[model samples]
Target: MVNSITGLISNIQRYSLHDGPGIRTTVFMMGCPLRCAWCSNPEALSIEKQLMIFDQKCTLCGECLIVEPEAISLDGGLRVDRALIKDIESLAHCCPYDVFEIIGNEMTVDELVDECMKDEPFYRNSGGGVTFCGGDPIVQADFLVEVTKSLKNRGIHVTLDTSGGLPWDQWDKLASAVDLILYDLKLHDEKRHIEYTQAGNSLIFENLDHLAKLGKEIIVRMILVPGVSDDPKDIELRCKRLRQSKANVSLIELLPYHTLGKGKYTRLGMPYPLGRNNEKDKVNVEEIIQIIESIGFKVYYRSP
Candidate 1:
């Protein structure tokens, strides 16, 4: 019998080629420890259920106003006091125009496994399987372990995409369960990392060193944000650290920053952290690739 372990899920993206090997069904679990300034999926940041207003779809029917007058107002346009809303879930149903949407959904272990199993044929044909990602999957480690175990029992290949911000014990068990680990290396300096992500790199680095020594397959993902993380020296420091740790790294994937998820902040009634001013900020791909390759690591980059 499958246990009734439930986890908060943000989205289950199907047919994704960028996450891991082959075509994958990336299960994005809710909640994260790091707040990357250039995060694309802002909805996945919070552990709690958040309301997203689609102002374009809203007919201004005034139905949602009846549910929470203080929270919902139509003074000039659709104005939502997100913090003031207590019954956030109720607003999702109250909107006849389907304007309001709740970001997170609860899924039991069995249900999630069943959902992933739907794409088993694709997984087998394309050498792909389910990948557990998140705001950072480590936030829901316990619940995901059961889900991963259930999937593995069904003969599915599993991958974990994480920032490695949590402690060792949390990653140890899950690392043993998954086949591939997509580890993120955001910033080399601990103070800058704290300033940007609101967390230190000490625990993350320690966990990476430990994971590497365990001989686990790891693909270090580095997101290049022009002003934030695009420094050559910092990148070199990260590569040197990985080399020093003797990490079992298959390759290093360079992810470029984009304004794709900026609109999500507006929907969630939150300010876009990096703002639109940096939209034109570009990264020197050739320079970054040269640096990583010179360090004796294979590189993977998809042109945007």
Candidate 2:
């Protein structure tokens, strides 16, 4: 019956170095509750299968138009009315060239477990295991719980990368199942948090507090978006909150923002929320690191 539990996933990246402790496999689960302005994995944000068109690969073939004439057009080039398209998979299949790609895949718990187990030897040798990330793995908490349980029974380490945006009750079972948590602390101000991520931080902070009380090992990851999340005052305040909560924060990781995902938005035929000029110089990395270290927490940052 465990084989019948299916989850939508965007990708399963293997041999990841930065996701967790050792060489690990990172499962990019599909779907998220938050719509952060600087989201890099736009394809994983939605829980449904989405059509990703690579305009460059298109050869102006009218085959796709024949499949869904109303949703596709070859006027000057390739044009897709994504909202009007049905049978996305069929439309993608109609393309002779891989100009069309599907973003998500449905995977059963047993299938996912087998895929992770393929790297079990590497996990054992490197102290690395499977790290569940996404649009936020908590979005598919039930499926994750079963998968993690199967993996745990096999002695594999599991990590949950999350924004903690959902209510505790929604993902408490999932939180208990993972060996470690890679928690994201994006913005502290509730109003500003909602403005940037389209989600409130109250529940996120509450869940962090709960994780702390449960003695869950947490590594706080903060993406240092230049004009948005780089405010020293906000960073300091966030650290103060983390310190006050006595969250078992292993360390703080400062991730610099990049425009790598901008192209993804284009492929999905969706406007990148952050404009083309959104890439600004990151705040002084040393200063940001010092700020976190000053609060009695170790810091890790990889320059972009």
The global Cα lDDT (0 to 1) of model 2 is: 0.91
lDDT of each: 0.89, 0.91
The estimated TM-scores of all candidates read: 0.97, 0.97
* Model number with the top lDDT: 2
Q: For model 2, how does the per-residue alpha-carbon lDDT over 1-304 read when each residue is reduced to its tens digit?
A: 5569899999999999998899999999998989999999999998988788888888986898788989988889888888889898899888899998998889999999999999999999999999999989999999999999999999999999999989999999999999999999999888989998998998998898899888989999999888788888899999999998888999898888988888898888889887655567648778888888998999998777
Give Cα distance to truth, residue 106, candidate 2, Å.
0.5
Model 1, 156-189: lDDT tens per residue?
9999999999998976888888899999999999
In candidate 1 the C-alpha lDDT for residue 302 amounts to 66
TM-score of predicted structure 2 = 0.97
Q: Lowest summed lDDT over 10 consecutive residues: which window, candidate 2?
A: 274-283
